[model samples]
Structures are given as structure tokens and as C-alpha cells.
Target: MTYKLGLTGSIGMGKSTTARMFRDMGFPVWDADEAVHRLYASGGAAVAPIAAMFPTALDNGGIDRKALKLALANDPEAIERLEAVVHPLVAKDRENFLQKHSDSPLAVLDIPLLFEKGSEWQFDGVAVVSTDADTQRNRVLSRPGMTEKHFEMIHARQMPDAEKRARADWIIPTDTLESARAAVERICNEIVTDA
Candidate 1:
């Protein structure tokens, strides 16, 4: 059986970079964001249901994320409704990935909201990537089209970094690439050895 490790972090915490480190180490990584993107792309599983719920979110036979964001912003409950349609699909995608890598000793599931969604239970262990608040804010704000307000909104949705670290089986400090990579290697060694 594969050991499933749920990797998570708030925006700008270097979760994507950490996921890449795992990939570099030859571990199969299933990215939840990428899975959602696949689901939102044209001819994907979520287009019809999402379009049915918010026609304005439909663009060229696919779900337009920007338009969906606007719709969700206008309606306080829209996020929940959207999740209701998408979560099952995402879960199915993850399940398929896990099954595909069943023989592997370790598989990483890169889930941005793993803790917030109460999905930590689904994995054998959880790793939370984190950085100081200032670094996180700076990294996020430096991104194109990222405003302070947008950063705050995204940050608010995630569980606090401290809380996540407290709950994590391993905490990967992403203050620098070297540190993060070292943590990843350590975690990988431990898990693979035990597996």
C-alpha cells in the first residue's frame, strides 16, 4: 500500500514549490489545484454542473474561474454551493491518482485546503509548509494582479499557519528553498523507510 502524505499550506507559503521538490525526489504528486483546473477546463466533468448553477461562469463551453469568483463574491453562499458540485469530482480524481500509485511507497497529495476541508484524515500523514507572515504577504503581493485585499481574502479562508503547523505530522519551513528541500528529504526518508 502507498503511504499517502497530504501536503498543504496557505497561499504564498511555497506549497507549489514544495510539491515540486517532492516530484523532483521521484515521488508521484497529485495536485488538487491541477485536478480542479482539469475539471474546469473545456469538456471537463464540472463544466455542465457549474454552468447550470451559474451560467455567467461559463466561458467557451468551460467554467471561467474569474467569472465564477465574481459570482461567488456577489453571493455569500455561492462558495459552498460551488464546493458541493466540485468536491466530489476532486475527491474522485484524487482517489484515482492514489489507486494508480498504489504500489509506490509514498505519494503526496498537494491539497491547498486539506486542513480547512477536514481532509487530513484521508492521508496517512500531513505536512504543512509555512513561512513567516511577512514573507508570505510579500510573496503573495508580488504576484501579478495580487492586491492586498485579495491576499487577505485568500489568507482568511485558510486556517492559521500556526494552527496548521500544530496539527501537522511534519512542518516544512519554506523560508528558503534549501530549508524546505531539506525538510522534504527528511520527511521522504522517514516515510519511505517506514513504508
Candidate 2:
């Protein structure tokens, strides 16, 4: 049986970098954000449903993310409505990935909202990439087009780092690449050994 590890962290917590480390270590990694991007691409499974719900958010043959963001911001309940349409499709995509990687010794699902969406139960273990609050804030704010309000909005949607750390089977601190890589190696060694 493949050991399914759910990898998660709030925005700017270095989750993507950690996911890459896992991939580099020869573990099959399924990225939820990438899946969503695929689903929102032209002719993707989510296009038709999302188009029907938010016509203006469709550009050419695909969903325009910026337009969709604006639409959601304009409507107080649009996010919930949008999630109602997209979550199941994302779940299906994830399931397909798991099926494809079923033979692997270990599989990592990189989901930013793993805990927030209550999907932690699907994984054998959960690893949370984390850093101090100041580091997280500084990292996020350094990105182009990221404002304080936007950061706050995104931060508010995520579970607190403390809570996530408490729930995690392993906490990988991403303050430094060396530290994060060491943790990844340790986790891989431990899991593979146990298997």
C-alpha cells in the first residue's frame, strides 16, 4: 500500500518548495494547485460548469482567474457558490492522481487547504510546512501585487499556523532551505523505513 502523505501550509509558507523537495526525493507528488490550474484551463472539466455559473469570468475558451476573483469579490456569497461547483471536480482529479500513483511506495498530496477542507482524514499522515509569522508575512508581502489587505484576506481564510502545527504529524520548518531539506530527508527515511 502506498503511504499517502498530505502536505499543506498556508500561503507563503514554502509549501511549493517543500513539495519540490519531495518530488526530488523520488516520491510521487500530486499538487492540488496544479490540478486546479489544469481544471481551469481551456477545454478543462471545470470550464463548462464555471462558465455556466459566472459567464463573465470566462475568457476565450477558459476561466479567467482574475475576472473570477473580481466576480467573487463583488458578490458576498460567490466564493461558496464557486467552491460548490469546483471542489467535487478537484476531488475527482485528486482521486485520479492517487489511482495513477497507487503502486508507488509513497505519494504526497500537496494541498494548501488540506486541513481547512477537512480532507486530512484521506491521508496516512500530514506534513505541514511552516515558518514564523513574521517570516510568512514578509515572504508574502515581497511578492509582486500582494498588498496588506490582500495578504490579510488570504491569511484570514487559512487555519492559524499554531493550529496547523498542532494537527500535523510532522512539522517542517521552512525558514532555511538546509533545514527544510534535512526534515524532508528525515521524513522520507522514517516513512520508507517503517514501510
lDDT (tens digit, per residue) of candidate 2 on 1-75:
899999999999999999999999999999998988999999999999999988998998999999998888889
Q: Which ten residues in a row have the lowest lDDT in candidate 1?
A: 149-158
TM-score of each: 0.96, 0.96
lDDT by candidate, in order shown: 0.95, 0.94
Best by lDDT: 1
Which stretches in model 1 have alpha-carbon errors above 4 Å?
A: none
Evaluate model 1: give its lDDT: 0.95
Question: lDDT per residue, candidate 1, 1-195, as tens digits?
Answer: 899999999999999999999999999999999999999999999999999999999999899999998999899998899999999999999999989998889999999989998889999999999999999999999999999998888888889999999999999999999999999999999999887
Q: Residue 189 in model 2: shift from native, Å?
A: 1.1
